[model samples]
Each structure stands twice: as structure tokens, then as C-alpha cells.
Target: MPKDSRQGSTLWSTVLADLRTRLDAGEFTERFPSDRELVAHYGVSRHTVREAVRRLDMIERRPRVGGLVRTPPTVLRRLLDTLTALGVQTSRTTTTGEHHSVEIAGRLDRAPRTLLTVHTAVLRADGGPLICLQICSAASDSVPSELADMLLDGSDRESGQVSVVYEGTVPAAPDPEVCEALGIPTGSVTFCIEARLDLADGAPILQRAYVRPDRYPCILQFSAP
Candidate 1:
């Protein structure tokens, strides 16, 4: 039996091969050319360039609409700090609470069957909803009522020193609630990030966060290894 030669080739396949050759020859060092430049050079559509670059893992930073891209809470304890560093100010639009009465096992060393309080807020920048934050915590956590309310209106001083670790990220099609909040189309693809925040003692203070990445483009920085 012989392998089919067509199986490994595509219209964009040659583009990737050319890029790989250029990379080996030290053509790209710090950044890749813009999508427009690549399309003109490769004679392919912008979509082809995006998909090829994505498959080759040659691009990291996403195109931001504003001056700087929002760095997701991968490092900063305060998500507000992350956004501020990106040069954007956020205002909370709505806050809602969903309390699960049924006993549930807690994450990050909390007691089993602990009550969970889920607080969700839609944050805006420049008068448009930027992202939706769904934060969950153990109901026993000593969160001040005022502080909880502050999360709905603006940033607070107490929401720092918490270590945030991303648990997972997935692509999802927009639902009605998300579409309305982010003002995106009903079926647009959105990036959803789930993370856990823990106290200094390693106990979980905040269980999780759900972030909508449609409006908030992520800042991806890489260095030579």
C-alpha cells in the first residue's frame, strides 16, 4: 500500500512550508508580519494567513482594538490591575448572585459539602461591555457585603494578593446572555477562561472565574527559550 500524497497538502500548505523555511533561515525574530503583508507576499487571503499562522504557532499576540491588549489574570492578582496596565478602565454594569444550597465539594482545601456563592458581573470599558466575570467563592469566605457590592460598581482595594491560576480555557458559541452582555452576534465564537484564586496559605478564597474574551483581546508575550 502507498500513502496518498494529497492527504498532506492543502492550498495553504505551501504557505506554511515557506514560512518554516524562512524561520529556519532566521527571517522572523521578534514578530511576524501583519496579516495584510503576509497576504500580499503569499498571495493568499487574510483568512488563510491567519489560519496558517495559527496552525504554525508563529503568532502570539492578538490584534487589539484599543491601544494595548488586555492581559488576562495570568499574573496579576487584581484583574483591575491587569486591565489598567493595558490602559483600559472598567466599570461594572451588573451583578447577580446565585447561591447553591445543595452541599457541594469545595476546591483548594475547603471542606466538602460547602456552600458556594457565585457572583457574576459585566464589566465595561469606554461605555461598552468589555467582558463578563463570573466569580465563585465559598459562602464561608469572609467577603464583606460592601466589598461584594463594590465588585458590582468599581474596583476595590481589598481584592489583591490572591494567586490566580487558570484551570481551563475553551471556545464557545455565544448564547443569549453572553451575546447581550458583550454585544456580539448570537453565534460568534468566544473564548471562555476558567481560573481559581487562592489565598497565601494555599486555601482557596475564590473558586473560579468565567471570562468572555470577545471584547477583551488577550496580550500574549513570548521570549526566547
Candidate 2:
């Protein structure tokens, strides 16, 4: 029997777990299983299946209708979930860059225990012409010495190592300095994550990522506990 068969909350959690299991098992084959197939396999309504799928997307990205799904990383980075916690109560992320933009300017109240104050940031992501960040210290800071070297040498970095930020209000466009930092052309677009990592000794690690926004949307569903 499954771990939790009880209805409502328990059932929802079970479904979400099972959905992730199937995806990891290659049930989707770089594509989504048909709605009918999913319904039959999960023995649930279309709505329930949709909710389960949505959660998997938030935890791990999936393929678009015709795009290929990227392979999940072998080692799940612990940092991703911790960073996402700041966004749990988010409302109305009204722009192309919603999922990836966080306002580093105002993360003072509930800053993560691992981070010190994020003093300031200019560049926030990789894949741009010049990925630049001048992070200050926290006693336990673990940002590799090599990373600083990598950025200064003009190497293009992925968005994960950094985060993106936006004011609570939407803007006409993402920060151009961020685009330039990420090595993306001024006009080219991508999905990004703006965040503040409480690093070293309560030091704030900030990012301003520019990414293809349509590719990512943090979704959720509810069920029994």
C-alpha cells in the first residue's frame, strides 16, 4: 500500500509524491503523458493530476509542448528549496520575470540564518557578457574562491549560482546590467531567478538574473497533511 491513502491532505501529498516518482522513472519520456494515460495511471480526476504535475514543475522544471525536457540534476542542490521558502506567500507576480525576480533591496526582516546582510549587488546571473558580483563576508561564507576568478575572467555562468531581484511592483523590463552580467545579449531573453542568499555570516548574497521567463512558473496544489 502507499504511504498515505487517507483522503484530502494525505491523498494529495501521496499523489504529488507518486507524480514525481513517475517522472523520475521516465514515464513522460521527455514529454508529458497523455491526460487519459495519467488519469488511468493515477486513478484520479484530471484536476488532481494537473495539480500534481504543477507541483513537480515548481520543484523541477519540465518540457514545454515541443521543447525537450532537461535532465534533472543528479545531486539536488539544497539551496534551491531554502531560497524558494522566501516566496511561499507570494501574490501576483505580474510580469514575464515573476518566478525569477526577487527584491534584494528589502530582504531585511526575515533574512535567512545562513546569510548576513546583502549589502548591495549590481550583476545577478550568468550567461551574460559580464557576470559581476562583489559579495562581502559572513564568517562561514562558502562561495568558492574559484567562482570569483570565473566571473572576473568573463566566463558565462548559468543562472543557478546567482538569483534575480525585482521590486514588488513590476517593471517595463529586467535590469540591463543583470543581462550584461549574465552574458546574454541586450535583446536576447531567458528565464532567471533573482534572490538573496544569506551567506558567510549573515552576509547577503544577491543576484539579478535574466532568463526566458515563459519557461518557468512556480505552481502549487493542496491536500491532506
Candidate 3:
């Protein structure tokens, strides 16, 4: 009689392949099995089970017009709303201060000598850091105070009235300040979303957001039309 002989790395690969097939078949619909359950079901060591599960975490299947397509990191307009919808408890830390800047003034279409109010926020999910956001606007009466208040409190005010000039993700190596804010290591490769939002009145709001994709993976799905 021949004995079943798969072991070690070979066994881990076999288990991973089987898990992928099961995932495609929607076997684990409600929830994924635990390590103990997987080990018992596959008759493999816990180490092998862990190795397979770790790789599975990196796999994201996105549907497209033709077929499944790879997804790139992208910006989420309503960050707090999305997280809450996903049943993740979120919290925010915001700081507002005045800064004298020429570049920010130029972006907001104000005079170069204008003062700016900088609003910085760190959004956390389940007590873990997720996004570091900064907004710059003119520190004058012309700019509506409610806009600043809404941003500071993570309200959706003026969301429908704003137009996005540019919104996308870029590979970034965050500076020491951003690294500390997002709780990521210095020199870590991450995604930064730079967006220029314009109000109906032509007032510009410059927003820069640093996102930790590993902690908060940005997955976008599209259906074929």
C-alpha cells in the first residue's frame, strides 16, 4: 500500500492551491476558516497552513469589462463613511493651525502674502492608523468658515458642491513627519493621494493624503457593461 507523502513546502503549495479553488467556488462565503480548521481539514502542519494563508491575503480579485483585472491603489472620497459601512470603528485626530505659505496661497488662488489655515487629521480604524490628511485653505473671510469646520469634523458638508480637479494615487516615501503621523516606518513605500477640490465659486482646496495600503487595502471592483 502506498502512503500519502506530501509534506513541508510541497504540502503548503498544495494546500494553497486547494484553498484558491475553494475560494473561487465560493466555499467560504460567510467567513474564512481558522488556522486550526484548515490544518485539520488539509492534514497539514500549522506552519504550512500559515504560509498559505499569508499568501492568500495578498490576492485580490477584481472584475472588469473583459475579465478579472489587477487593482491599483486609489483615493476614496468619503474615507470615514466607507470604513463605517464596512463595520470598522473609526476615530480621527485633527489639528488646525495658521501657516504663512506662498505655495499654498498659489494653489488656493490667493495672494502670495496671504496667510493659510492648515487642517491636519489622522484617521484611525479599530485604533490603528489608516490615513494622514492635510488640507490648506485661505485664512480669510472670503473662504467660508463652515467648510473648514466640516473638514475638521469629518462631515460630508459641501461634498456634492465640490468638483475634483485631480484625484489619484502616487508612490511615495513619506517624510519623517508623515511617517510619525501615520505610524509607518520611515522610507516605507506607500500611496499618497493628491487632490485639488474646487468649490462652485472657484475657491480651491488642496488636499494631500498619505495612505498605508498594507493596513488599509484599497480594492475597487467594476462590473462589465
Candidate 4:
């Protein structure tokens, strides 16, 4: 395909076919130029750029759009940390890979209690394979429900950040039931996930999640400040 491809075909069928050929022929691999770059190089408009890479084409990957537009690792880390922003949903699935449950843990009025916890199977949006098993625990007496049950059916009304405050909380070890539920070894390092606990409490409360970092990662996105 010529850089300034003004073939003027209204129906991008031919153009798309050509673009796909270019892509398959190693024309747009490892990097996809921006609309401006494409225009400067190919004499196409921003509209053509959108038409080429619109959502309908299933081209959602960032590198497909911003080939060399690399983000600082720190910024990417911080963005990944915020689960909602990344479209990371919590749900459960049977061993047969059937969709089972979807729920959220809540908190109650200001009270120091291990309120809500959950065990969920994480899946990528493309739904190709199971990503990981996410076992989350909240210590705030905010949401009063079994963590597992919450995974089945629960509501999350508050928008807050889950953080880690202190280490070596009382009991100091993973709860036996939680360990069983999450299938983690008894001596595994359980992450102390301290969330904002934004419910009835004005200040942050202790929401501890005993996680196996090996299976699950603490995802956060960070960019150059």
C-alpha cells in the first residue's frame, strides 16, 4: 500500500485488505504509527486512521496504535493497580471453565473488623484462558459478608484505592479457612492488602488480603511524573 494511498475507495474493504496484507507482510509489526504519522507518511486523513484502527477491527492493543509510544514502566504499573480502570472484573468459574459467580466485598459503619473477603477466578477480556485465581481479603468491618459468598453476589458502591498499611497484623498468619479457600500453602507469604476501606469509616481501616504473589501479581501502573 502506498504511503499516500488516496485510492478514494469509499468502502474501505479494498483498503483494509491491503492494510491486512501489509500487516501480514511485516509492514506494521512491533509498531503502528499514529494518525498524524500515517498521514504524513501515507497521505491519509485522521478519519482513515480511525477507520483502519477503530474498535470494530478488534485492534485494541496499545502497541498497535502507539507502536513506539512507550509509556514509562512506572506509569503503566500504577494504572494496572486500579482494577476498575483496567476493566479487571472479579468472577468465579468451575474447573470446566464455566462462568459461575461475580460479586464484590463491602464494608459497614466504622468498626475494626475483618469484614469482607473473596475468591475469584480472573479472566482476560479476550476470554482465551484463565488468567489467575484472585483471593482478596478485607479486614474493615465495613462490608459484613463472607468473602466467598461476596464473590457470588455483592455490590461495590464506593470508589477507593486498596493499599497496604502495616505488616504483621494480629494473628500474623493466613487464616486456615482462607488458606484452604485460596489453595495457598500455609507458610506462603500473604500480602497485606490494605484498602482505603471507604465505607462508614472516615479514616482508613485494615483490609488485609493474604495473597500468593506467585500466582497473582500486585498490578499497578506508573508513568513518568
Index of the highest-lDDT prediction: 3
The positional error of residue 13 in candidate 1, measured at the CA in angstroms, is: 34
- Write down the TM-score for model 1: 0.44
lDDT of all the models against the reference? Answer: 0.55, 0.40, 0.68, 0.40
TM-score versus the correct structure, for each prediction:
0.44, 0.30, 0.53, 0.29
Best model number under TM-score: 3
Model 1 Cα shift for residue 125 (angstroms) = 1.1
Q: Which stretches of candidate 1 lie over 4 Å from their true place?
A: 1-86, 101-114, 145-160, 165-168, 173-179, 185-188, 200-203, 206-225
Candidate 3, residues 127-224, lDDT tens digits: the string is 89888877777877354545534553444333544556767667799778889988888888767777787767777888778888887667644445
lDDT of 4: 0.40
In terms of TM-score, which candidate is stronger, 3 or 4? 3
Deviating ranges (above 4 Å) for candidate 4: 1-172, 196-205, 216-225
Ranking by lDDT: 3, 1, 4, 2
Model 2: residues >4 Å from true position, as ranges?
A: 1-6, 58-225
Each model's backbone clash number: 0, 42, 0, 26
Number of clashes in model 2?
42
lDDT of 2: 0.40
